[model samples]
Target: MNLLEAFKQTKFQLSGHGNRNIKVLKDAFEQMDEQQESDMYGSGKIIEEFQDKLASYLGKESAVFFPSGTMAQQIALRIWCDRKGLKKVAYHPLSHLEIHEEDGLKKIHHIEPVLLADKNSVIELEDIVGMDEDVSCILLELPQREIGGQLPSYETLESISTYCREKGIKLHLDGARLYEITPYYKKTAAEISSLFDSVYVSFYKGIGGIAGAILAGEKDFIEESKSWKRRYGGDLISLYPYIVSADYYFDKRSQNMDEYYEGAKTLARLFNECEGISTLPLEPVSNMFHVHFNHSKEKMEQILIQLYEETGIGLTHYLNKTGEHSCYYEVSVGDRLAAIPIEELRNVFNLLNEEIKK
Candidate 1:
């Protein structure tokens, strides 16, 4: 059966609703009315209101919406670099900007990225303090996504913030999954965002929005980004659909992020106890973690198909292979996983282990 068909038939799933159906998405936009209007090249009422709510939630003086996180971060870095007269921006090696953006910062914006820390570990305050090069900004991803969603200590962040302020380096947050990590840090999004000069948040990831990102900062900074957005061909004529979907999902699912975080740890614990499986980072620091298994990626895919066919549970959509018999897959715990009984989760893990052991 096709993967989408499999997911459609499953009663329980292990990840968030990232791969939701078109019908489900269509329902999210049913509230659009005749009175509803589109933003006119970034000047519409709905987009403005959406930006205001994001700015308020992020505790920034102003905010601008972007079509994608790529546009948001690139524009933010360019603004900082233009003001500072320095082209260098520091970030972790595995950061989305570094690895996923196709070097857009360097090729398009002329911003040089200095990779910080080892790929396996989170960026540290010591690394920031020790860096001697002049940089316009330093970017940090809370709950580092590439490394099993690990976050640095609050004390460490304070130290880095203090150093950046003293050094005149703008601190930018790639808070794509900001809501997902709120439960782990025991802090509000605004409190954490306060530490940075500019913050870029995604509407899609943990917020479950359709697709978009928000860049918030002091009035002048975001205003500069607004011009940059136009320059980058990102000023969409109408963004009301994306804006409304973001608003609805944040209201509906964002409140339960804490439950998702706790449930992630719970599920990781159960997975670790199973045979031929290990949860990267052992204890989950956010609503996601990496599960390593002694099998090929193809073998794991077969296992997922078998389990879904027989038990009506879709364990995971994809797995990353590391070695000949070593593979890993990210397990995202969300409302879907939380809705399932813990004993069923346990039974599924036990069955998975039994297959891998055989």
Candidate 2:
């Protein structure tokens, strides 16, 4: 059988909380009151309360919910640029805005992005200090996801924040997986977020919600975003479903980040013990990391499929080719890892080591 088929058949998976099926949404709504009112076009108690909760949690004066992080972030950059009368912003080259957003920020908003730092490395304070051109805002992704969840030190983050405020440049956070990094940083969400002038967080990444995002900042900044939200066609008649799921899962999983962080370290160590296998970051700074295999993509797939069938422990269902002889996949620890029996997990890794050595 193919890799995905084998992974589907496995009894357990090493990444994510569980299958993201309709059941995920069903479970979130199971405990809700049948008469609970739904949000309408971004108003009503459901949407407003969740936004307030998130804003308070992130230490922002206000917050707004969006249908997607893509929409929220584009609006954020546009607002920053309009305020400064400069259509330019700075961020890592591997930023979602650069690689994944299809230039929406550039096309829809006409904002120019100044790419900073090396593609494979996290942006340092020095990179920001060295920028030649002026920008209205600087966006930083904590535990930079594209680089195997690598992170700049808290001291570096402080230095960058201080520099941005001193230069009148707004600092924005693309904190898609913010909850996953707090354990490593030993700080609360509010503490980390206070450094940024504005922050955007995703509900579906580490939080495992259906789909939604929160944009938080000063009251004025968020108020401006609401207008842009309507202009971007983001104001759906009802966003109660997404908001309900986000709220339920945030409560259920947010406190489990510390457990997930430990689980990630344990899993990474097991992978590193296997021959021809290594992990980015060597040690994970968050509950996510990339696993690299020295074998070609074709060979790794064959090996992983066999492993899954034999052990019924699915490490990953897919791999990405990095080179002719190198392949990789990402892992984010969650409730699923905790469900696997310890003895079975040990045996799976032991067998994985044997197969990789061959």
Q: Which structure among the candidates has the greatest TM-score?
A: 2
lDDT of each: 0.85, 0.94
Instruction: Candidate 1: give the clashing pairs.
Output: 39-44
Model 2 C-alpha lDDT per residue in residues 120-200, reported as the tens digit of each score: 999999999999999999999987998899999999999999999999999999999999999999999999999999999
- Badly placed stretches (over 4 Å) of model 2 are none
Global lDDT of model 2: 0.94
For 122-143, candidate 1 gives per-residue lDDT tens digits of 9998888878788999999988
Model 1 lDDT, full chain set: 0.85
List of clashing residue pairs for candidate 2: none
- What RMSD does each model have against the real structure? 1.7, 0.7
